[model samples]
Target: MFKLTLMPQNLEVHLPANSSLTELEFELHGQESISFGCRSGACGACVIEVMSGAEALGARAPCERNFLASLGFDGEQFRLACQCRLAGNAVVSAVAAPR
Candidate 1:
């Protein structure tokens, strides 16, 4: 099992290694507000900052990479939550919605 820590709110969700971010988000839906649009990584709505265990998440998909590049984000710090699969324990900080 993998422990996902959502920061700012500090909500933690335990999930299987095979679980997708979409599934995790849905599971925690009412507990917290997470910004997300395309579950396929085509949108940048689900980006998060990895606070710990960065190596535990899956690789960035092509769409995520493109979006990240467009935003000039550091590859090591940002991850598209929708594109990342849980592998082990991870602590991530949620990004606030645009004003």
Candidate 2:
């Protein structure tokens, strides 16, 4: 399993390896620490910062890369939660940029 720590609020959620954020909608969405929109890469509302263990989230796909770039977010740490999955443990902070 992996531990995903949502920052500022410091909430911790556990997931088995290779889990997607979309799979956690029920466990997460209502939390004020983060926000989700569309649950797809098109909207930037799911933007999150990998506060630690960034490699755990792996790489971004072409569309996600493009969209994040368009939103002025660059680097591996910033990810669209909807577009990412957890491979290992990760700590993230919601930095939502709603569409």
Stretches > 4 Å off in candidate 1: 97-99
Q: Which candidate should be chosen as best, given TM-score against the real structure?
A: 2
Instruction: In candidate 1, list every pair of residues with a backbone clash.
Output: none
Residue 50 lDDT (model 2): 84
Candidates in order, TM-scores: namely 0.85, 0.87
After the best TM-score superposition of candidate 1, give how far the Cα of residue 88 lies from its true spot, in angstroms. 0.3
The global Cα lDDT (0 to 1) of model 2 is 0.81
lDDT values for all models: 0.78, 0.81
Question: After superposing candidate 2, which stretches have Cα over 4 Å from the reference?
Answer: none
After best superposition, candidate 2 residue 59: deviation in angstroms?
Answer: 1.1
